[model samples]
Target: MHSSSVSGSRPCLHSFKTTLPLKALAFSTMMLPLHSINASKATYQFDTVVNQNRLIVVSVENPTTVFDKTTHLHGFGYDLVRSYANSLNVKLEFRTVKDNASALNMVKSGKANFAMTTASFQAIEDKHLAGFSATCDDSSVLEDNGLNVNLNWVFKHANDPLSQNASAYICNTKQNGTISQLASFYNRNVVKDESWDIIQRDLTNRMPIYKASFQSTAETYDIDWHLLAAIGYQESYLKPNSVSPTGVRGLMMLTHNTAKAMGVNDRTDPSQSIEGGAKYYDLMLNRYSNISYPDRNWYALVAYNMGPGAVSQIQSRLKAQGKNPNSWINLYSYLERHKASNSRYGQATQYVTRIRAYLEHIKSTPQLVNL
Candidate 1:
């Protein structure tokens, strides 16, 4: 329910092009819990389909078309909706489903507050069951032979009392506060990184091959080893031969020009790619050095995926709104609502979220300590 207004005129900033820190505080392995203070304990008389303290978002994995699986719920739609929930001081609970049809059924059945698996309301087989929020990412939905082809939208059960709340919050025109600035109203606790015993179990075989390279690269770049490994896992799942559809190659998915710039001759070489990506990541970190811990790495990862220019533009926008552009959570709210398509806000946010999830997983792994 909390909100702020952004100025209509967008300001441009070029200061982000300056030098960044080559070193950063090592990411803490200690896990922290999110804020859960309810000392005053004010209860709301009206509790809609959404839980009083949480929002249940139904979705399915559709990386290219919807939510990025690597990051869980960090896509454009997810970010936008989640930001709204956060504004209301509610935690988000994402429910994975088999498909959009099933997602709609969940909402219709009152199981979830909304169905947000990149479905266009117009294309739904049963349109009467749900209503969609005003499309934020585009002007109108595109139809390919009467089926949703291109358009991003979310839906809630037509009968759900919280549907209006969902609509108002999702498409609400307001300024999102930066993390550093949110102490005024943000009451949630911060969650600490968890142990990655599960990830280590899965990576047992590959650890022997890449552990040394991960350690060496991390040291050379003055970054956490797990970060490098997390990026590798997200980009190509630690497969040295992996190549992205856009021509990014190798374990870290370095593009041709990026590889050359980093002095990498063989993009497919695991060691070489890891080194190059690490160096590039370190450089990115330096650029956002002014940003605080956690957020610094978050911005760097976004820059690494979407390029520094896009992130720079985002920072500038945040600054124009009298916000701390250095705060990722603050930026997430703005990025979620931004109308511009070129910024790649959705993809960049998702990329960072996924990298963070992986980093946390790796940090939790006790085996990494030995390396």
Candidate 2:
């Protein structure tokens, strides 16, 4: 259970008008893990989180909703909850679990204050969980009895004081368009649109072919398997034999020089290409160990695409403009602006954003997790 306090009064940041990287880092520092809290068992109740020094949230990690393994909590849910926690002046902690069942169980067991998960109404009724409809993200659950219920997170009790605050936060943010801005800033693409439809179609049809290779690469390099897969999708749309005009080939679209460097004997072979990509990406990650998790991951992705020299130049540009060199948004904005002058750089920018959108979709949707 990693926890941190955010002090000082500052307006919650908007997309383009966001505060500096220092401030963003300050607010985004809250996060979680799960364990028995017998010591605080007596004090553990849903409302106690507000009264105590911390706001404990239990959730599963996904690119958009959560970053479970990172040193800091980020993504969409973190932003929303950070606002609510700061308003109450409590340190926030997100207790991450392996699945929705674990998240709900923690909240029900009083090990957590609130849960962000989805369930059929019958499951909610059976577990006696309180789902806040306002917080729904257009997801649904199919009941064991074959009924569909809107996806939702639940409170411990119907009348828990936390419910009122949570509901207010959702409605207020929705009315102010903060939710939309946050979505745009995080995902950087329209959710479930034509492009999304294509991705989904590919996910169902194309992803299964390459899933095991990615998983194997993940175990070897200790990277998120989905992230590598997402990169592959962005590169060649998951075509195993894809070839760029410049001769970068295969699922990962590795250039011949890069493939040889990574010891990939055949760039057109899925296993060899994916292994080469993973090895190359691992090399980039090693260079970025000085940075933090999640940020380091993003920076490494940029390095992998545009080369570390390019990343250094971009960092120099950001610093010259008084921006944080380590800030992804700053880097993203710089890339967005310079893309007109350099189409390659712009593609690199889109590369990351599209990967992000794909990751969010894959992680948020339960059906896509295993596939």
Candidate 3:
């Protein structure tokens, strides 16, 4: 339950408990109750958690919660819970679970301090565990398939300090419009172009053929395979023979020039194209070497579609406006303006947006469950 109890080992960036399903890497730890004095909060009985060190949270992946998973924790619920953890100056130890029920059970059983909940103000038939639902659920698709998402942090005891503080944090953020800003900020990502039926069909019919290529290519670049798969799906719906008018083709829709540059000889070969795309994507990452990841990943992805020159232009524009150039949320309104004025931003934004949407499905696939 506590860090000291985990064989004196510190969990790396990615870890989880997968009692019910496909995959995870983990060590057992949980959040402990509050100490009698502020100075004593760091101590624990079973050593579930210490205020000065770790705050463990459990969640099922959904857009409203964690849309991504263990490799990199991300999502709206992840953001909210991370903020709360930051307030306490503790490291957040995110634990992924198979369902809402597993998450609740973890909290009740003291394996985590709290659980992040993403329930429909309407119900969703299919579900998966991304970190908070973590990274992938932020957007619906390029189209408007938005839904009202209600997320909450569930605690074991209503009177516990972790619970009370989380409740207070939510209330304070809501009162200050921080929560609203986050919701509005993420509104652009709620796109669902593929119906659940289509997603299932593709999962069954198409995914197995290219899974190894996705896994190998992504691992070479230290990228999540699901994220790479998302980009591929957006490019050609995972069709090995598909081609665009501009001549981008194959599983990854690689242009002839980009493919050649990345050492790919066959544009129609799935493995070659996937490898080429990963290389090109890695090249985009190098273009913004100064920025940190997740943000770097976002920028590189946009650059993959819009060209590094366009991303540079956006950075310059944002800097001129005194905004953070490295952040994707800042690009949203700027891209919207370009779409309004000249319709130039649609393809680039669509490129990133669809990747975002497809990632949720790729991560949520019932059979494969690529975390």
Q: Give the Cα lDDT of each candidate.
A: 0.56, 0.65, 0.61
- Give the per-residue lDDT of model 1 (tens digit) for 53-134: 6678777544322334332233334444555565566677777676777886776565776666555545443444434433
lDDT of 2 by residue, 44-76 (tens): 353366347688887665544565543345666
List the candidates' TM-scores in order.
Answer: 0.48, 0.58, 0.64
Model 1 misplaced regions, further than 4 Å: 1-202, 339-343, 367-371
Rank order (by TM-score, best first): 3, 2, 1
Ranking by lDDT: 2, 3, 1
Pick out the ten consecutive residues of candidate 1 with the lowest summed lDDT.
6-15
Q: Cα lDDT of model 3 overall?
A: 0.61
Candidate 3 at residue 338, lDDT? Answer: 81
Q: Count of backbone clashes for each model?
A: 16, 2, 29
Strongest candidate by lDDT: 2
